[model samples]
Target: MTSPRRWTLRTENTGYTVRLSPDGPWAELDAWGPLGVEDGPSALDWSRRTHFITPADAAPAEYLPYGLRPFAGADLVASRPGEERGVWWDFEAVEEAAGSLRLAFADDVIGLRAVLCYSTVPGTDVILRWTELTCTGDRELRLERIDSAGVTVPVSGPARLTYLTGQWSQEFQHTQLDLPRGTFTMGSQQAVPGHAYAPWLAVQDGASEAAYGVALEWSGNWHMTAEAEPGGAVRVRAGRVPHEGAVFLAPGETLTTPRLACAFSPDGLDGLSRVWHRYERHLAGERLRRPRKVLYNSWEATGFDVDAAGQLELAKVAADIGAELFVVDDGWFPGRADDTGGLGDWYPDPAAFPQGFGRFVEEVRALGLDFGLWVEPEAVSPNSRLYAEHPEWVYRIDGRPARLVRNQLLLDLGRTDVQDFVIATLDRLLTEHAVSYLKWDMNRPPTERGRPGADHADHLDLDAQHVAGYLRVLDHLRAAHPHVTVEGCAGGGGRIEHATLARTDVVWPSDNTAPLDRLSIQYGFLHAHAPHVMSSWVTDAPGVFDPRPRSLAFRFVNAMCGVLGIGADLRAWTGEQRAEAARWIARYKDVRDVVHHADVRLLGTPADPTFGVQYDDPAAGRTVVAALSTGRLDGAPLVPGRPERLRLRGLDPRARYHDAESGSTYSGAHLLHYGLPFAWSADHDADLVVLTRQ
Candidate 1:
């Protein structure tokens, strides 16, 4: 007889509304779409439906606990020592503060409280949701699983899910499937967010262009499970610090789950990408103002033979070719002729660098290029003195042989002593040298993740503690040495997420830098992350994933799409090739601002005969399109046809544009309708075309 109580949340362009069901205090999503859609009846209200599951289970509640979410999986699972694994919670209070909304529920009998939190990511069509569980009872409770938030998409018919999946060097391969029924699950348990799958998902209503996206903001083990309900609603639940068993929660202590960002886009997956990009840029804030530098890393050139004379030689050529930063990769530490040793030895190898590390850095600075170094701080090799002295620091299960991944053992970062040691190591290096950049890489996930203590198996929240330690070190770097740029890498693209992105300047996309393979990797990466944070390298490796021998220009254009880096051995390149790289670097500096800050649009995928990334900067009256021909072509004609053109979007039709290369002019209307013509052929496989509004 009485109308249900309701609450509506809105971002710049979208809206989300939830209401209390008439039969119970539990909430259900009423409306979630464009602005001004909050006044209608909620499609997920259980009061309007008939039969099936419990009231809380049937209703599309925002967040529910164990006993309440009976038949279905609960967002929060908890239990006391000898009690049943469930809770009968009732709505207690709702609070709104500082643009954030919170709803609290309490189970008086169990002495537990759950708070669902929501806040809009300012200036964007995205809202972040998370949960906090507090132990209110006198006895401690165990939390087996606590998800950030449960999102219910108001969909009819089936839901199409889009996600990224792959391994190690071949990460971020976009994959999609239609789910007419049942549930789909994806996650990582390898301590760090593993390479098998990323913690992100996008759901579309059948074939509609409108879509909803969810991304978990966590660097540790996480999970995302999406289910297509029988009644046509799609529900997604995600969280972090996923453990095999319950983690103890003491009285008066509160555990907060990772934030799950929910976004809405009306223009399709491409448009949804812009929403995510804008949010990431917002997260960067003042850091976004800093330019993405063109760097030259000396990893592929001289692996373990990192001597001062050889490094200085490479630095001279790097400076000549317009590299702003010069990084000396691994194998620069003592006892480190190969990957088998010298991991924990942080000091520069005296034998390899007879001219002192500081002097080597000064020599690089004299060449007009900033100095950088690579360090893997969380791993220890048995051959190193640090590990030999403190072998207990490495993670190991008692009575079990230690597992070695990449010939190194993972440091138990959960220990405060280990965290302090890592901080001291990086701090001393940056303070002693004039290092402008630091490439922090993690080569492998923790294999035997265990603490040496007896109580750790059930009492210690190892994953959560390790993540906190990692973030603390990165935060220390950002605050203590603001001048240093930090590049985050975990065997390439393994540890990328919002929490890591907040503290680091850039992330290595993958170890597979082959032209076509990298293009595919970057294509999927840009959809979820901003380009400024994607560190792309032009390497001469003989194809780790793709074997196609693409031209130098093709490699340059592909790497230019993100923060450009050169890892090829410069001395091995021909004079003409060196000259060509210099030209491309010069050209890149001209359009780097637009490329980094502009709204990026992925024209087509690498699978297409002709695909490109279009950077549209309307405010600056400029657009840079790095078009590439991936498929086979002939001089007589482009693979598909000379008539094939890339129709541009998000431009004013009345404006006229001038092409920098051809010196030709065209109306914005013409470019939007017809598009930029690509003269693709055997000789010209790729072109970085810049256009200025006239």
Candidate 2:
């Protein structure tokens, strides 16, 4: 027998090896880590203690069904009408490429074939994995659980897990915990990926800096569970459209699971973030390097009192403040006097734009700025004309009452008819106004989530359908309206994933823009995602979430860390504040390229009194740093004996550096060793320092 074959998949710096023995019915992950790991004895080659349970149950099974691995949790679960739930599949065939692999397993009796798919992203340390299930028999099969991939991490004892979790106003809070035993799981039951938790997980040995990360690309209901088996092996399983009963698989019909992207980093979670960012940029393609304009949004300024004159006034101030794109946020549509109405309506309110919507958009553009608009396409208020005309378009059970959150019902995006209407609505708006930027928002999740007329309501898999239809519409936007830039938001950071990042130019992190609160939120966000896709805004100071007094300079530095946007009502700003905003905006544009496309390192977390981010680009000959004092400082900004300092990273020790703002020069060795000194006063707590290497 040909030794069941073994394949090693290589990314830029890591290697993952899987083995299938001719004697066993299942495959196992032999090794995973640095490139040369497979050249030596696999760490998994150990003595087996499989006395009571089968080898498939004791081994690190890649992906298995119930019967063969009856003890452990299974990856695939299926059943025939009058048959058992177990699927005893046998390894059948495999297809391998330079950086890709596909393993097939078939259960002849059940007439089902499952294929595990794997491929490496070209330029990054990321491997995308998914699954394909084909029903080969005449009778339809019910698929209860079909996961994308099963990841096995070999460990001696406990493993550490890191994930992002938070709620509506406070999203993307970095969380970490120990997985010493049992199973830890996180997921979203809402039709959309809710604000509860992001579909991402990272596992590392105890305190080791080396980390392995897995993120689901599906923006629908999903689950990621990490199980630390009794034998000291940690296994993670992830999938989308989950916990919703089952789906019917007819003969010859195949269902492809969503891709689960896997990444590795030797330098820790911070390093792992760059891996994710690189892959996101790879996913973005041409949109990656595109200039992210300095934007000004008119939501907090005008609110529902939007009108032709008020917006133009704001536009003049925005253009004067160096805003490249001007966005008219919510309350622009008819019937939208408040959040309780005018959600589904696509056209602009004639009363607000009596001069005509087309002319208003052109007028905003006339101020040397690109015009933008915000729309929540997947929601409908009871008072909306679209909802009144097509009440059946929303998700609802036949005779059940619909629950309304935020006075709106989520549209059934799964339906092709609904997708068509959404596409048509957005296309018309973009075409009529010649809009250059679009902010697509979804305010609520599905409550009923039912298709009234479906034959097998239990097997509908509404989440999958909705997600597919949503991606379809996004694809149409990319193809048909390629000239328009898109920003994705689900209330705020609720629906962020690779799929959304691939399609949209940026995403809103949170609704709370108070400096200190937003600083922590952006800190957690940059740990898991890249800066290019992060849309940070500077709103009014000392408002709402955090009432702590913060300088406008602090607010600008906080927002400038990402794609800078001024959400504050500039018309209300004093002349000094407006001038300061213009200066900061100009400075951001000067170093925006390095900030967006350079090596980023976060120094001292929010826990430290002075924490900030460093962006370094040797090719650009620029190194920018934004340091903010989050806690109380001692007497004197520049203490005689102990000056507040921040040690820089990724700098040559022997090189000389010049400070653009202060005309100060120092050795890179001294800057990196003793650190750069900050003379921050009580009112001046933050600074954006630019350094040029000489």
Candidate 3:
């Protein structure tokens, strides 16, 4: 027989290979990671393990197929008459281009065609995969489960599943579980890529230092399922959640799944994480190089009591402490005394800003700081003038009572008028004000999500479309105002995802500024996202929510790990505290480039409350490690036997390094193995160690 077709895709230190048999139509993952073979496994031999009657060579194991043959986990599921109500795509053609591969499969029986796309970058060990399905038949078809990508992992022993789980103030807490014999599924149906669980998953065998993972690039409700087949093999599939209903496709109609990013690592979880960070950085592109200026937000400091004079005082102190951007949040708008009013009214509140924002902007600029404003265009307050003027603009049924959260109702952005108003208002704001930044906050979830004319039952689809419309406005606004930077905040961090991050410059990790609580929150966050785009603020030491007072140094060090911002009421600070903060701000500037551009490694797991993260910039020849003690550092140690030393990684082992904090010199080997002693001298004490290669 002719040699079976084989292809190998290599990325840095990893490789992915797929094998196809001339006699069979299925595409099997021959090898992944370091074990990937360059030459063909052309024999197509399975006699060594086969027990039942062997299937046709054309129908080998499928990585992405419907209930055709004995597929483990189908990537595409469809129904048609006379065919067991499933899709069976026959292999047609395969094309390879620069750093990309395309495979075409068609099921003439149902007139459906499937095209799978795969691509990889130069320096990262990740493969981006997504599928496009086209209907060529004259009849309609129902698509039940269409996944972005599907891959089978070869397992020799027990495998563990690692995923993220958290809620509200806390997000991306990593959770691991041993694979069971049945299907394990996780996703978000909350209309937003929620805080409860991140859209990333990995199946790893630490024993072999082998792992396979995938992250979906979708923002709305999505699903991922890992099925452990009867054998030791496991199949993973991911895509948008079809909870609304099976999507109906008419003749000549086409549908595309969200891109699913997959990565393989032979160096365990840390390597896999580093690969993901690099991939995200590559995706971020120019944003990574753009300076993430230290910003000062007047939310925790002033709340709804915003005014020009008070803000000017805050802006002076903020600029004094090295803040580059000054943002007035919430109360700047007309009728916006609090969350209950002044949402849709995008204009400045004439009373609070008697001189208008132009004066405030000019004063802020005079202090050498840029200006920003907070706006929630996707929502309307029931008490606002905009609501009274355009009641039908908000999401509601003709007779049903409008559901309110945080005294606000969600605007149906799916409507063209809403999208137009948002674009025009934001464009005007950028055109008129010298505003350099915008804090876009979505404080509430969608309720009564139906359009004015659409049926209530179709609201789920409307929710999905609303998110698209929101993206459209952002796209247009960004295109029109390229100089303006936007920060995404859904209350806090609720709207963080690949889809939203594509347009916004930064994301608010959480609303909770409590340093102690943020330790875990930030740790969970970096598991899937990068640090440069994560907006962290050093609010008041005693935090608005968690009243546990922490040292200024502790708060500063903790917040310094990400895009540093200060939200505290600086006007109330003592002279000594202000001096101390100035020093820390200077220190953060000293390391901001390294922290933002380096490869991030989350060093500790959630079970270990005393976790830390390391940032390494090989080109800059420096590394920064920030370790935090989440529990009480005052009365008693929470973990009585917690390790006092933190062994750093991603360092050049042969080089000599200088510890700037201790003014001590040590070999890289010593720092890697012996580690620096974490002197948790006080309650909630945080430690930051900067190592410079000498």
Clashes of each: 0, 0, 8
Candidate 1 structure quality by residue, lDDT tens digits, 651-687: 7899999996898888989989999888776768898
Candidate 2 vs candidate 3, lDDT winner: 2
Q: Comparing candidate 2 with candidate 3, which one achieves the higher TM-score? A: 2
lDDT score for candidate 3 against the true structure: 0.77
Candidate 1 lands at a TM-score of 0.97
Point out where model 3 deviates above 4 Å: 1-4, 21-24, 35-65, 69-71, 80-84, 397-399, 455-460, 541-548, 605-610, 631-643
Please provide, for model 2 over 368-401, each residue's C-alpha lDDT reduced to its tens digit, 9 standing for 90 to 100. 9999999999999998889889998998888899
Look at candidate 2 and tell me the lDDT of residue 175: 90
- Model 2 regions more than 4 Å off: 1-4, 21-23, 541-546, 637-641
- Measured against the true structure, the TM-scores of the candidates, in listed sequence, are 0.97, 0.97, 0.91
1 against 3, candidate with superior lDDT: 1
Error of 3 at 94 (Å): 1.5
Worst 10 residues of 2 by lDDT: 634-643
Please give, for residues 151-255, the per-residue lDDT of candidate 3 as tens digits.
677666667898888777766666888885678888887667777778889898635777778888887778888877655667787888754556767789898
Root-mean-square deviation (CA) per prediction: 2.0, 1.9, 3.6
lDDT of 2: 0.86
